[model samples]
Target: MEQRPGKREERKVTESGHRRTAVAESGSPATGARIAGLGAYRPQTVVSNEQAAADAGVAPEWIAQRVGIHERRRATGSETVVGMAVEAAREALDAAGKDANDVDVVILATCSLPTAMPNGAARVAAGLGCRAAAGFDLNAACAGFNHALAVADGLVRSAVARNVLVVGAERMTDWVSAHDRDTGPIFADGAAAALVVPAIRPGIFPVAWGGDGERADLIRIRADTGRMEMAGREVFAWAVTALTPVIRAACERAGFEPGELKGFVPHQANLRIVKALGAAVGAAGSVTATDVTHTGNTCGASVPLALHALRQRGELTAGDPVLLLGFGAGLSYAAQVVLSP
Candidate 1:
C-alpha cells in the first residue's frame, strides 16, 4: 500500500521550546503541515482576443492558434498586486476556517511589483490582519508559486510557523508593452493563495528545484529600459525538452506512478506549452489545468491560480493527489506532488 499522509502523531516539545515529532519529522501533527485551503482573485476587466490582437498586430485566430489564449484579466485602478494578494488570502483563510491571527508568515511571489522598496508581503499581511506575522517577497517569475509552496512546507515542518499563507500575485500587463507582439498578448494579471498549516499527515511532498543561470537571458526585464522581452520559440523548446525530467524526479521523490495522480496543475504559460508538457509527462485522463486559455500567463500567479480554478471547476476533490509543475524565466523551474485540499 502507498504511504498515506495525515497519520495521527503526538507532539513533543524540545529543549528549545519548539514542537517536534515523528510525524512532523517524517510523516503527522495537529501542528504536521498540510494545505488547508486555496483562493484566487481574477481582475474584473476581461480583455478579449480581438482587443489584444489589435494591439499586437495579429489576427484573433493567430493569437488563438499560437498561445491558445482567448481572454485574459487586466487589472485596473485599485487592483494593485498587494491588494489582490490580500483578497485571495482572505478567501483562503475563510475557507480554511482560520483567523488572520493564525498565520505566522506570509510569502508573496511575483516579479511585477511596481516598486521594490516596500515588500508586497508586508502590506498583504497588514491587509489580512496578520499583525504578528513575518512577511517577504519571492520572484522566481513563473516558478514563484511552487518555490513558495516548498518554503511554506518546510517552515511548517520545522515548527517555525503554525500557519503560513503562500500567495502568487502578478500584474504582468504592467511590465509588457502594448505594441510588443512577443509579450503583450501573452501575459496578464491575477492572484491566488494557499493556506498551509500543521496536520496529522504529510500533504506537501518534497520539491525538485533547479535553475540555469547561463540561460537567464532567454527571458529578462531590461533594467535600463524597464521593459519585458523574450525569445518565445527558444523558451518553448527549452520547456519541452528540459522540464519533463523535473516532473519525473518529483514523482520519484514522492513515490507516485504516472497514472496515480488525479490532477496535473502546471504554471499557466500557454496552451501549447501546457499540452506539450502534459503529454511529455504522460498526463492522460487526468484533469490537467489549462487556465492560460482564459487567464493568460499571469507569471508567478499562474500555478496557484490554475489550482484554484481547478477546484472551482470541480475537476479535483479533497485529498486527491496532484502534480504541480512550475517553469519560467530565469530558466528556473520546480516541481512537486501534493494532496489536493
Candidate 2:
C-alpha cells in the first residue's frame, strides 16, 4: 500500500530488540503560516535628544548627526515588560479578529526582565485571559522578535499550535545607564506583537539567521554595575559589512530580489546602520523604516514596531512583500520576507 504525502512509516528496533513499525503522524492541514495581525505599544513618556544629551554628556546636535534620533519613548514604572506585552497582544488579537481562546501558545521575546524567577510569558498570557495557552520566553536579544516570529511560523505550520501570539517587549532603560553615552540615547522602551495563524499560502517566508558567540562581548550588560555596555563602532562595522548577504539570502529564499521588495523594515538600531544595510541590499525603491528617529532602539520590539509604523503611515498595503531584518546583542541576526497583513 502507498503512504500519504506527509505520512511515513519506519521499522525500528525497540529496547527489547523487537522490530516494530512506527507511523509518523501528519501535521495540520495548513500549507504554511502567516502573520494575521500586528500591534505596537509605545510608552507614554518621550525622551528628547536634549535630555539624553544632558545625561550622556553630549550636545543634542551631535546625537542627531551621529545616530539620527530626535526623541525616543521611555517606559515608566507602571509599564512593566509583561504589562506592555499584554497590551500589545490584546491589540494584535483584536486586529487578527481572534480572541484569547484562539491562541494556543504565547511567546514573549525580551531581554530586559529584572529577574529570571517567574517568566514573563505566563503573566502575559494570564493578563490577556489566555488561560489555556502554553507560554514561554525567547531571548535572542535584539533579534528576538524575528526569531520568535520564525518559531511561531513553524508552530502553526506543523500543527503544534493553531495560533501563536509572538510578542516583543523591552524596558531597555532598566538595563542601560542613563549616563552611558554608548547605550543611553540609543536604547528605549516599547512592545509589539504578531498573531500567527495557518494559511493556505505562505505569508511568512524562510529566515536567514545566524549568531557569533565569539563576538558576544561586543555588547553585554556588566555584572558589576548592572548596566549595558557596547562597542558601538565595532558593532556598526560588523553589521554593515556582514548583513548584506543575510538580506540577500532572505530575499532569495522568499523567491524575490531585494529590488522587488515593497518595504524594508530593519531593526530600528540607528539611522546610519539602517541606511547602509538598505543601500547594500539595493532596496532603494523600498519604503525603508526610519522609526529609530523617534522610537530609538527598542531592542526586540524594534522590527515589529517599525513594521507597525509603516502600516500606520499607509506605506504598506495588504499582500505587499516586506523584508524584515533584526540584528544586535548576542551577535545574533535573522531576516525574512513577510507579506504585509
Model 1: lowest-lDDT 10 consecutive positions: 22-31
- Residue range 1-341, candidate 1, lDDT tens digits: 22334444455646663344423343433434678999899999999999999999999999999999999999997999999999999999999988886777899999999999799999999999765678999999999999999999998877666688999999988889978989999999999999988765778989999998899999999989899999999999999999989999998888888788889999888999999988877867678899999999999999999999999989999888899999899999999999998
lDDT per residue as tens, model 2, 1-341: 21222444243546663334322245335677888899889999999999999999999999999999999999999999999999999999999888986777899999999889699998998999875677899999999999999999988777666679999999999999888888899999999999987777899999999999899999999999999999999999999998989999999999998788999999989999999988888976799999999999999999999999999899999889999999999899999999999
Span of 10 residues, lowest total lDDT, candidate 2: 1-10
Model 1 lDDT, full chain set: 0.88
TM-score of 1: 0.91
For model 2, the stretches where C-alpha displacement exceeds 4 angstroms are 1-28
lDDT at 62, model 1: 92
**RMSD to the hidden true structure, all candidates:** 4.6, 6.8
- Once model 1 is optimally superposed onto the true structure by TM-score, how far is the C-alpha of residue 245 displaced, in angstroms? 0.5
Error of 2 at 173 (Å): 0.3
